[model samples]
Target: MVRAAARLPLFFLAASLVAGFLLRAPRSQRVDSEAARQSPRARTAVAATGELVKSLRIGGTIGTLRSAAIRAPELRGSHVVGWAVLTLVRLADAGSSVEAGDVVAEFELKRLEDHIADLQSYVTQAQASLRKRRSEIRILQGAWQHEALRARAESAKAVLGLPTAEVLSAIEAEILRMAAAVARARGKRQAEVERLRALVIAADLGYFDVWIRKELLHIERHSRDYKRLRMKTPIGGMVIRETIFNRSGEYAQVKAGDRINSGALFMRIADTSQMVVRAMVNQVDARTIRVGNRAVVQLDAYPGLRFSGHVAEMAALASPRRGTRSAGRMFIRQIPVRILIEDKDKRVLPGLSASVDVIVSMGQRGVLIPREALQHETGQQAGTFVRVAEGGEYRKRHIAVQGLSDTEALIRSGLAPGEQVLLKGLPRDQRR
Candidate 1:
């Protein structure tokens, strides 16, 4: 009877546990279903019509049209060895207005007197030598004529039988000797005349005249060494730079000698009335930005102010380097571009840093969306999913996109305008 009672209690306990387990299973499933229904839905919007877009922005500098450094003229003047500049008489200062034929500076002339005096002495000596040569030639000619007359008289006497054979022979010998002397003197006279003519020409032209002119212009165009200086503005505007000795006793030091060769840059003048911002672009990008394209320039020095400009020119060839980040490297595929400022003020200076925006294209209509929305599937086949509301549940539809920019892309055939797309977050089941 004890065994039977124990078995009865055990059976009753097993039945109660089975009933409790079955009851809790249904409740758990119901709770899970309700939580899923309460899950937050992602909001979306349709790709809409917009204007055409461009990319590839860069910064550059605004520089003058030209700039030069003024220097001394190279004309041959009295080179005062070991004589430093005593003073600088500056006729023009930096930024000063100048006209053609204006004197810029003057040098001290005391050192040149000696050279001039030496040239004068050379002229006098040449003249005196020429006069002495002429007198000697005249004396030799007279002696030759007398000897010829005596020879002729003696030959006649021989023919008339009034002179001996020896006398005739003596006269003939004297005539031959005198003839040789006359020829020699005539030759010397011709040589002296040629020499005097050359000297006269030299004196008329002036000593070192051609050389001085060439050297002077060369120095004006190229070198920065001179004692006296004059600068006539080649182009009328402003003297962008002037290196004049300011102190009354100070002198600008130059190279020891006065000769300067070609291609030397002495002084530079520029027209500052207009300014242009020059920027370099990859050769590929440069092709897209043609001359006459409109651009917007922003100066880093002036915040919130934008300047308008247009593409003035493009480089015909690439720079000597390649790649964008290589500073000063030869660009194998990059070209320089110039942008002309529409309105320039005094604030614009050469080498001012500025940024540019080139408009490659524009439009008022295209289906576009943020670039992040696209998802790659396989090979060239890429797509994105659009959320469709069906029976209070979200369903994903795959769509195609095209025409990508840095920030946005065009939805070529994926979804139509006005259809909503999920942008904030993806559904749990649709997460990548």
Candidate 2:
């Protein structure tokens, strides 16, 4: 009887444990059900009828639409034959703001200036030498004139003596006649010598004239080169130094004391006031883009920032897309499109990666919601759907999508304005 009583108490304890477990199971499930109902499975949005704008998104770089490339000025004028390796003496500070006519770069003008000064001195010396030669020739001509006049006088005197020979002896007359003939001969020889000397002097003067003129032309040419050596910006903006092959055969930014070839891409002055995104569109989608279409530009650097823009221009011809291509897809081409950003912001700079959404179509009235709100069915039911909110619960509703955009979708049927839809995707049982 004692064993039975102990066994009975043990059985009662076991029974009590079983009964509590069964009773607590239902209460735990009810609590879980209440919590699930309290928390929302997906975000909800009310559908509204409004203008739907469809946009085509494209990736590109942000750059100044009116920016000008500052290239190394071509060396021109006399004595500069072939390509001249220009030595940079001074360069404008990189990223410095500048205006039109501001001096951006200067070559090693010391050498050119010294050369010009030397030429000037040479020109001065040549002028002096030419004047000295001219004066010497004049003096020689005067001496020749004096000598000719003396010869003529001597000849005249000899002739007068011959006329007096009539009252003198025959030997004296013969002597006077011979003396006059010799004097006449000497005069004739002197005249010929003076004429030849004058011709030679004129030739010497001509040589000096030619040499001086040539030197003057050379000086003019070098002077012009001097001016060109000082590079100036044609348009005002920020100066951006370009990469160059330095003396060490490595590419580096152009700086003072670097030697650059003429006509090389030296630098650029980008107009930050007006920026544009040079984006590319696949050739197939290029037909839908048109000029004057409104666009929204967003820079990758600043995720929250957006700039209003418009389609400024489109390239008529397509070119091979830049960057790497996948295998067997080497023939893909893209059309270049330039979008002009109307909003001014300091952060808009060149070479920034940007996303441009060009609004190709707009002003269509329809019931619109985010494209994420629409769900696609599979297998047996193949159509678009949305989880519509009805009173306190949600139900799946069929919807007809008329058009789709980068962010929103236009609903044509099976959905109406003032209806709420779920944006997040939920399980079938949970959605109900």
Candidate 3:
């Protein structure tokens, strides 16, 4: 259930609603007419004894003090082009407790997986092609080596014939000289063959490298896209899906069938152990609320339950509260305050509406009575007057009420302990 927290400070404007010193209102008693028939008024009660404290209630939401927001896996720093849209296939339900490294949301990964499979297959094919190219180069190198050896042998034979040319006839000597020149030229062709051999080696390596680069790039893209498909909570806590405003001006939770933009806030994981209430105090009352002030936390869902806490942090700056615009001007400036919950309870959850009452003064023992016994004059809510049974006749006794509570009121003066007073109906304004 979502609700606004702007009306909390207004709930407790006068007396402190904090439950530090509990009120013990004395029970109303029935008076006998035999004692007094002159002033037959209403029921009477003796003043009881209890302690009273002054506090102020500030409205806020109960949340984990050390919470971390879990967003959609962001690939902004990565080299992905254009808006990345993903289909949500699996997601953890809201309010479920999760452990560290748990899967919070899973997107449609079949497409990514299929692309990765293709890239892997290409890598395999590239490996095979590299091996095949190496084998072919080996065969070609062997042929070149045989040609060079044959050329060297022919050159050696030609030189042998030249050494005996001087003893041969003129025609035989000329033919032998021409044969030696041709053999020497043929031997010199080995250098060109070696150049061709180097070219072939380079060509084969270059062909394999072209495919290798393509294979690595595809593999990199596949790995990066695959990791972005699944998202996880970094710490152990509860999961809360964030509500995103779409281009159509509609706010909705990121769910299945919803396409999320790149770098959009998706989900949040909160630390449940250290819970606190975040409240906004008016600029005037903000000064009274300081860090380390003891307070009482109350939840709307669980009535009659009070949790103890203390102010943990105070905002260094004040700003206008959101959604408080009216007549083209700012409404009120509020200071954000954080109160740390001292005790743990099952009902305490993130985003739950709660209120914190700051204790301003320590409790002191005083004469206490039920708030019903005090009667207020018309148009006045304070300065309750009581009908005290004194001098054998019931009369009005104006008493000074120092502190008040839901069911009790502390008399600072005028009303004494063990004194009898007439009890009225009930107060018009309720404390809580």
TM-score of each: 0.46, 0.72, 0.66
lDDT of 2 at 372: 83
In model 2, state the lDDT of residue 185. Answer: 94
By lDDT, rank the candidates, best first. 2, 3, 1
Which residue runs does candidate 2 get wrong by more than 4 Å?
Answer: 1-48, 76-83, 150-193, 320-334, 387-397, 413-432
Task: Put the candidates in TM-score order, highest first.
Answer: 2, 3, 1
**Candidate 1 residue runs with Cα over 4 Å from true position:** 1-56, 66-91, 100-117, 128-229, 242-264, 321-332, 365-432
Taking the tens digit of each residue's C-alpha lDDT, what string does model 3 give over 158-205? Answer: 888897888999999999999999999887778777987798789879
lDDT against the true structure, each candidate: 0.60, 0.86, 0.78
How many backbone clashes does every candidate have?
A: 18, 0, 3
Worst 10 residues of 3 by lDDT: 20-29
Model 1: how far residue 148 lies from native, Å: 5.9
Q: What TM-score would candidate 3 get against the native?
A: 0.66
- Prediction 1 global C-alpha lDDT: 0.60
lDDT of 2: 0.86
Cα-based RMSD of the predictions, in order? Answer: 18.1, 8.9, 17.1
Give the Cα error of residue 139 in candidate 1, in Å: 5.7
Cα lDDT of model 2 by residue, 281-310, tens digit: 999899889999999999999997999999
Residue-pair clashes, model 2: 0
